[model samples]
Every structure is written in C-alpha cells, then in structure tokens.
Target chain A: MSKHLLTIIDYGMGNLHSVAKALEHVAPNFQVEITADKARIAAADHVILPGVGAIRDCMAEIRAQGVDTLVRDVLASGTPFLGICVGMQALMHSSDENGGVAGLNTFPGRVHCFPKDALDVHDLPMKVPHMGWNNVYQQAEHPLWQGIESGERFYFVHSYYVEPQPAYTIGTCHYGPEFAAMVGRDNLFATQFHPEKSHTAGLQLLKNFTDWNGRL
Target chain B: MPLAKRIIPCLDVDRGRVVKGVNFLNIRDAGDPVEVAKRYNEQGADEITMLDITATHEGRGTMIETVRAIAGQVFIPLTVGGGIRTVADIRAMLNAGADKIGINSAAISNPAFVREASERFGAQCIVVAIDAKRVDDHWEIFTHGGRKATGINAVEWAIRMQAYGAGELLLTSMDRDGAKSGFDLALTRAISDAVSIPVIASGGVGTLEHLAEGVNLGHADAVLAASIFHFGEFTIADAKRHMASRNIEMRR
Candidate 1:
C-alpha cells in the first residue's frame, strides 16, 4: 500500500478526517495525505475531492488556493480520481445554490435543487437536503462498481443534485424521479453518496478505488 | 434517491465510557466507546451518535480520544454531542474526526450559536439535539441531558432551530428515554412536520416494531436507540429488515 499515495484534496470546506480515516482503515500502509497543495495533489498516485460544506465556498477556496486548475491537471493526468458529495457537485458547470454560483465546469451540466414538491412513492415529501442512507443503483459495469451489487444503499447528505450529461452518468437514483447518483468515465468516479459514512457497501467502494487502475 | 430511513446507535458516555441510564438516571456501564462504535458500524448503522453526558460541566477531553479512535476504525459518520457550546468547541470536535457536531444546551442558551456555527461550518455539519418530555398537554424541551426544563415548546423550537440553519434535529423524549416504550409519535410528528430538516426520533425504543413505528407512524427520518442496540437485544440489520417488511422504505 505504500506504493499508492492517495491524496485527498482539502479546499478548507470538507469534513476531511472521516474520509481519510476510512480510506486508511480500508487499506492500511497506503500513504494517505490530506492536503490543499497542488504539487502534492498532482504528484499523488490517486486524487480524491471530498467536501461537506457549501459548493460556492468550496469552489471559491479551490480557486483561491489556485487548486481549480490543479484539479483539472490531475484529471487530465488520467490518474484514478474520485469525488464525494460537494466534490462531485463541484465538477459541474454551475449550481443554483447561494443565488447561483459557478462550478469548476469540468463536466457540462448544472447542479439543480431537488424539486420542493418531490415525493417518494409513498407520498412522503422528498425532503430537501436529502440526508440519510439511500441506494446507489449502478448504471454501468465499471471498476468502481466491482464486487458491489446494484441497489446497495450508500449514505447521502445534500439538497442539490447534479444533472450531468447522460454519457457521464454511470449511476442513477430516485427521489422524485431518476437523477445522477454517480458519474464516471475512464479513470474518474464521483459519487453523490459518502462511501466513508456507508458501512459494508461503502467499504467495498473504497477498496475498489484503491485497486482500480483508471481503466473502464 | 429516496432518503432511506436511518438507524442510528447512540452512545451516552459519562466518563470516557459508554453508559446507559433510565431517563438519564441510575447509570450502568455499557462498554468501550470505540469498540461499541466499531461494532455498530460493521453491523450497518446509518450513523453513530456519541453523547458525552458529563462534558458540559468541566470538559474532560477524554471523548476527543474516544472520537479519534472510533473514527479511525469505524469508517462511518460520527456525530458527537455534549459540552459543545461554541464555535471553537465545534471545531475541536470536527478536528477530532466527528462528522457532525450536536449542540444542545448551548443552542438553548443562545439560539444564535447555531446560526454562527452554520455560517462558520455550514448547516450540513450542525445538528441540534432537543431533549423533550410531555409537560401538561404539550411536549416541553429540557436541557442538561433532560434534567433542566427550558419551558420552551418542542415543536416551535424545532422550527426555530431549522430557521437557525440546523441541518438536522435529534428529538429525544425524556419521559420515554430508557423506558423503551416507543417513540413519542405525536411529539415527533409535530416537530418533523414543522421542520423540513431531517428529524431523528430518539428515546423509548423498547422493541423492534417501535423502531419501524418511528419512521412509519412518527414520520421521523431516522430512529436512534442505545439500550436495544447496546444490550444485544437486536442488531441494526434486524431492525432494517423489520422496517422493510412493514412496507417502510429502508436500506437492508
């Protein structure tokens, strides 16, 4: 595991410890570093963008720290990269939150809020900030989906949902209707769900990330 | 995706050790905080809530180590409560690897604390734990771990907390705390209906069915328990299966 340096990009907005702790737990001896330094992020064998706060502040700090271009470079380097929650949302074109904020725009789409009138099959108000464990139905057979069965529940805590292009959407779930739960192409994978908070299914996903060779 | 009803296992720690009491009284030692949290995480708990019952008066600082150890191995969302009164305190907890910080007495003392903390850390990491009991005809809020009554109405306070940018509310019925009768459905519904943020129904979970009722009847977004999960009465997986069988949506 020492051969793999997994760098967790810290833009001063995420609950960083839990994600790093989980990754270390799954694969001990892996040199896991949590940093905002572009050199460290770019030099690591793998990169992860994880966040828990507002996307606006996240993007702001990412750009303020001059890591926005750094993130683009890491993705272009074709390393096995991942994003969680706001990290996944930050890759979009823009968000309607905080009275409209620009995103990194790596993927061509807008982050939209779940409809207020959204309801589940039971008519329960599909609450905003859909905070709880929900299923992540795999939309494709990618390396990140290895060993994990479809419809496995993963924890999520966010109000806004990303509307990435269908070509990039690798997973989908339903609150009112189907939305992108996960997006992946080539070596990159991002999840609206928090693999760190999720138990068994989540552990498998993290392990898969460690073993993934950035291949389809 | 539909928010799967959460099953949270709460550990009420008094002096660096997990303890269980009947309505915050007659304490009995449960187990190590780190090990118990790890077991719950492996059993598929949606989240882990650790309440330091004694930290409000003279911080012990032991729970920090407990949180560090638990977060290292648990690999799940850990929410820590008790003695979190200020922004600095919240930062310490988050730095100690707590996914979210739960504020009770401080929020009651100064409602603005929630707003300030939300502004500083965002609403996603802030949780307001409301300890309420039925007083007269309505549920009245309590502080100091259900010992002192604030005379504040439960539902109104929940609504206000949401307005204060509280991401979630952990509503515990003091009268039912440790009684394990079941969750106070009326009180839960009143609060959950008043606030759009997810409300975690705590206290009075004596049976497996009571857990399901917390979501189906009480409309609680999550059901939390200590005695049932800690005492080896039922596993979190068992509760999920039961809830799913009742046509209640859950992640099994």
Candidate 2:
C-alpha cells in the first residue's frame, strides 16, 4: 500500500509541531512533513494549514512565503485540506484584527472579535479568546466529522471568530455569541478549534480526516 | 452548551522526574513525567500541567526533553510552568509541543516582561501563574514556590496581569496548598471576578466535592491538583463525575 503524503504548511507562526505530531500519531501509515517548500506542499495528497497568534502576522508570512497563492491553488485542485484556528480565520474575505486585513478569500466571510464585554447566557462576563473546551454543534455532515457526535467539545483559543456564509458552515459553537466553529466547501474543511489538543474526540477527527477521500 | 470547566492534573518535574510535595515541602517521587501525562490523558484529564522545578541550568535541558517526550505521546493540551523566564524559554517550550507557558516569579519581578512576552508571542499562550498566601485581611502574592512573599495583593496582581495581556491566570493558594482541605473559595472568586480572563484555581483540592466547589462556588474556570492525582487517591473521571453531579459542565 502506498503511504499517503500529508504536508503541514510551516510559515514560522505559532507551534505547528504539535499539529504535525498529532497527525503523525493518528495516521501512522501516512508521511507527515512540515515544510515551507511550495512544491512539497502542492504535491502532497493531503495538506494542512495550522496557525496561531495574530492573523496579521500569519497572513503576512503566508503571503511573503507565497503560500497564500499556493493554498488557493491546492484548494482549487480538489486536494483534501484542513485549516485550524487562525488558519481557518485566514480563509475568510477579511478580518478585523490589526485594524483590518484581507484574507485569502477562499470563502466569502468576515472575521470579527468577541466583544470584550461579551456576556454569557448566565449573565457572567465571557472571557475573550474563549480559551478552553466548548461544545461544537454539527451544522452539516462531512467526512471530517465522521464518528464525532454533534455537540462534542473541542479545544478553542482565540478572540476573533469566522463568520462564513451559512452554506459553508459545518459546525457552530456558542461563547458570547454563536460563531462558526467549522467550515467546509467542496474538498476543503476548517476548524476554529485545535483538534490536536482536544484529547479523544480530537484524535478521532484527525483519524477520520486521514481516511477521508474528499467526499461528503 | 457552555464551555466546560477544565480539570488539570499538575506534575512537578525535578530533573526530568515527576515529584509531588507535601505542604510545599517533603518532596516525593511519583513517576516519569511523560508516562504520568499519558495516563492523565487516557483517563480524560481536560489538560495536563507540568511544573519544572528543576533549579539548575543543566536540569533545564532535561525539562525540555521531558516536554518533548510527553508532547509526542500525549495528544492533549500540555502546560509547562516553573522557571519560564524569557521569550526564548517560552518559545523553546512551545516549540517542544507545550500548549501554554506559565510564568510565576518572572511576572512579579518585572511586570513588563509579561507585556513583552505577550506581544512577542500572542496572549493565548502566555499564562501568568500567581502564587498567593493569605495575610491578615487579604491574600499576598508569593514567588519561589511560595517560599517568599512579594507583599503584593492577589486580586490587584490578577488584574494587572490581565491588563498586561495574560490570556489566563493560574492562581495557586499558598495557604491551602497541600492541606487537602479545599480551594480558597474567597480568594478564587475575588480574582476570577476581578479579571475577565479565565482563571485556574490551584492548591488544596482534596475531595471530589472540592473540585466541584472550585468552579461552582469559587467561580474558577478550571481546577488544578497535584497530590490527590499523583498519589492515586482519585482519578480524573471521579473528579469530572463529581463536578458533573453538581451541574458543572465537563468535557467527556
């Protein structure tokens, strides 16, 4: 059997090593490589873009490294792709972070910050970043969410959230307000939470992705 | 559903070995840090915190290797604290697969370090660990494993850390630490209410009920305990079950 080639785009942002390690752990038969080489990323059977920190810095690195264009090409070619955290936010049309920044615009959406004074249903002041495990309610069925139940929890850490078109939203989570937790269109899928740190359910999601063939 | 309250099992690593102390003294060995972390992950711990108590420069190298080993095997959020003093140190740990870096003494010694680190590396990964001991009318922040008191008010320090861009606060009560009684509800609530950031209530978690109380009464976003979990007195499942019984949402 031929080993699947999985490439994780490393643009010198936050810790992408953990994401690489988790993918390797879940898909042992696959070759998981972290690289900045566009050729290697473009040639992989499966590609993942995992990022953290500010979107401004991440987008700058993505554009400078020419990954911004390459990622759009990879998506256009119908390769199974996954975007995590800021990687997910970067797929939108634009973001409110760092004044204002344009995203790759692979999907039509805007990223907005959770108001600092946002309150929960219980009237308690909701913490920004939403840093911890929160329930992700499934919005649509997809191969990435196979075996993962609706309303399952995932680890999330970010102040801003992606507001994609309703048609592309696959999962929704509530913090101060309901926001897109997972989005997908055709062969590409993205999540605002870090499945790498979400324990059992998280590993299952990655394992499902490994077995996925870019089909619904 | 709302965000579930986290239950984190803390491992104090000395020279790459896991150790737990009684009353912050009389240290005893538990097991290997990597193995302990994996066990906690399998048992459904929300997260695992490894406190590097290695004092020497040589031992610091061991902590990094230990973090690397655990990150490879355990697929969960791992927080490394105790002696995180520089941006390089934070970067090393994060690069080694740590999800968060907890800074205690450094934040008190130079408050600007918190701002610098937060800006350099986003606030999401900067955790301000405040060790507090009750002094007369209020609690005072301490450093060096609660051996020295900084004479700073705990509530005020929490707000300052938040203002400086700390994503989360790991508030440990020096008075109740290792007492096996319960969390300092008043102290936890005071700091949790003062700051908008999430607070992890650490120190003196003895019973399953204590874990629930940390979130329900103390208003902590998470709870951390060392001895009870290290000594096998209770499991993470037991803590989550007890907390759930009290109506606190727990990630299954």
lDDT of 1 by residue, B1-252 (tens): 356788899999977889998977899898999889888877878889999988845554788888888888886688999888878888888888998999988898899999999878889889999999899999999876677888999988998999999999999999898998999999988888777788999999999999988888888888999999898999989988998898787776
The reply for model 1, stretches above 4 Å from the true place, is A120-124, B56-59
Residue B155 displacement (Å), model 2: 1.5
lDDT, model 2, position B160: 92
Candidate 2: tens digits of C-alpha lDDT, residues B85-197: 88888989998989889998889889999999888778899999999999998999987778887789999999999999899999999889989899999999899888889
Per-residue lDDT for A192 in model 2?
95
Residues A54-110, model 1: lDDT tens digits = 878888888898878887788788999998999999988899988999998888878
Candidate 1 backbone collisions, by pair: none
- Please give the TM-score that candidate 1 achieves against the real structure: 0.96
